[model samples]
Target: MKIRSRRFKHALASLSCAATLLLAPLASSIALAADPEKEELKLGFIKLTDMAPLAIAYEKGFFEDEGLYVSLEAQANWKVLLDRVITGELDGAHMLAGQPLGATIGFGTKADVVTAFSMDLNGNAITVSNAVWAEMKKHVPMANGKPVHPIKADALKPVIDQYKAKGKPFNLGMVFPVSTHNYELRYWLAAGGINPGYYAPAKGDITGTLSADALLSVTPPPQMPATMEAGTIHGYSVGEPWNQAAVFKGIGVPVVTDYEIWKNNPEKVLGVSKAWAEANPETHKRLVKALIRAAMWLDENDNANRAEAVEILARPEYVGADAKVIANSMTGTFEYEKGDKRAVPDFNVFFRHNATYPYYSDAIWYLTQMRRWGQIGEAKPDSWYFETAKKVYLPEIYQSAASELVAEGKAKAADFPAATEEGFRAPSSDFIDGLTYDGRQPNAYIEQFSIGLKADSKL
Candidate 1:
């Protein structure tokens, strides 16, 4: 009887040990999935297709999966969106890659804005009116009757000269002053030897058209086509589906994509006020995790899921454009002329090439553009550029969220930068003019440009 009792006790102890072993991993996962301090959130976005990660996160239950109930609202414009985020009216929003940097540095509205996730890469193009295209086409090289790709700004310089000879101000449109569109347009024109102008913020001249060749002004993204159609502007730089919208409406020809201007350039980011991020650290991480998952779903299987993504983006609450128009650029092809669709698989990268990671190098590039264009107003040390990038871009938060996703088996570890990544990318001359940009050497990179402010240059 004593032997049987002892055997029963031993079996019970073994069962208890096995149960604990099984529950260990479960507990760790639960800890990782801790309740977010703020469960209900309102986020804002503009009506652009690159806001896909936020849309995908909300549509696919990735937000709910992370214990977040998010209401996605489309703001009227970028300034309004930034203001709302700054006022805590919206928890976060899809932002231009330069917006946070601009805000943090007191360029526009002084606010402590920061971004943990880079939303997408290379979704913008410069579109010229049909009339402008007709004039510019004469200078472009022909390939079997179709215009040669990339259509450098050199093609448009003579056209600008014609406008100048006629005494008409050569005007162009960019979404915002600090936007990638503005810098890209300036870069392309400067590369072609047309001065895009400068901003003397110290003199309160934020007009950015001092001593200009091509006068640039702000036009909201969705209104780009109509504004150009009204002849208010000759050409504009903006993101999809607006560029594609021009092709569909037969209003303009997308001469060059930002992908052509600067291969795989960072476009937009997921931005929130620094206070919000500090107040809800857990929520922020969960938000990033959901977005990371959404991005993975986006690029997985060679973008096999893009068709469905286009459908979601076409919904009235999101981009609200026709599915066909959105799909023109979203699904690995971009329409230049009405039928000049070409395969550009990396045109709208969300996950691949560490697109989701907020590299410091990307931030510094925007800073360099600001300085080059005089928005920064003064030369900054290379260390200052690095420090400012560190202030605005939170890679640690991204890594934390990514690590959780990898541990939970939702994402592969290889999908992100290695653990030793110092948040800088290797130097490459990916610009349309073949100028090398080493993020570590900002002044040297700035000096290579002929048009804008040099490293020691003053306004």
Candidate 2:
């Protein structure tokens, strides 16, 4: 889809959507300016391109429209961000999808963090250092002069074997213990028969490299390229603009994106403490309302505002990467090596495919990953997955925001999920391993994996 002038105007229409929504009947649009439990808010985020929704809501005046003044802060790391939100220092944050689930399940710092809005989908990639890529390139199939992509981890297995044969360990980095990056890296390596290791949190084993081919650990997102260049880790799985930063710096090549692993996979979300959400229900709903408008602006008319969005994200306070680096993935194309650019329009999906809506299947998938890698440490009934998803993912709040947007003519009913949606996506086999997953029957889905524990299997 081309970025056109008319669509740019459409993208900016959300500016007026807020003002128009204010004039709506008192019976309509649920936001009451007089009734917010709180107005001024502080939100936290790490410096990644997928944080655009929070940035957009603030910069575009969407928050002000809801009678809310928002202050967006960049946190040092995922743990700090989650801790701040949990401690009431920050009202909410851009969080990994697994953060809420991991918190609720007592995987890490146990707090009842919950998300009403899913921020974006598929903004991550697994990148290998130049030396590793040089060795792996020999095993990758080539088309013309470029290596065929959606590169399987099979290409890296030989390189790992060479490292092992030399009595050196091959290490990789993910952002956090329960991050989607860790799971995606594990999934890719396991699909190639390389054990990315496992966790046994029950036994106080969270190093995640108990029985491993490539030992995986945590490195903050901004530091990934530096860490790889310093020879600390061979590769990393992380969100943009870190992945694109590696390509631009000529230090590493992104082997495969998460999109290639699972098509339209859910990624980040806006998480707040469950206690905070319960105390300020109206404020939470209004915040989600502003974010939904921002998402719609982002994806309207095929991402027509993306260039403008890139410019905004490049500002010092937001993602703060070079605009060119951020645009590598933001503008509908992703560069693998220096010049091997290919169209991946959905690489940084903000709203398309109903990306903002929280789904039960999305939560269950993360829960399954935790169980598969032995983080959960025990088998549970399928009903537990469903109930956990309900507690963490607040689809009802999203519906309130969406309905308000519709009532005020700010969004069309057709543009949102059906009111009757049961909160599950149709079962999909869109994984790199070619296995289907049905959220309703998590045990059955777990059984389909060739590697990793089945429902009853333990570490």
Quote the lDDT for 17 in model 2. Answer: 76
Superposed model 1: Cα runs more than 4 Å off = 1-33
- How many angstroms is residue 290 displaced in model 1 relative to the true structure, after the best TM-score fit? 0.3
Candidates in order: C-alpha RMSD to true structure: 9.0, 5.7
TM-score of 1: 0.93
The weakest ten consecutive residues by lDDT in model 2 span: 1-10
Per-residue lDDT of candidate 2, residues 155-272 (tens digit): 9999999999999999899999889999999999999989888888888888988888888989999999999999999899999999989988899999999999999999999999
Residue 227 miss distance in model 1 (angstroms): 0.5
- Candidate 1: give the clashing pairs: none
Candidate 2: misplaced stretches above 4 Å?
1-34
- C-alpha positional error of residue 64 in candidate 1 after TM-score superposition, expressed in Å: 0.5
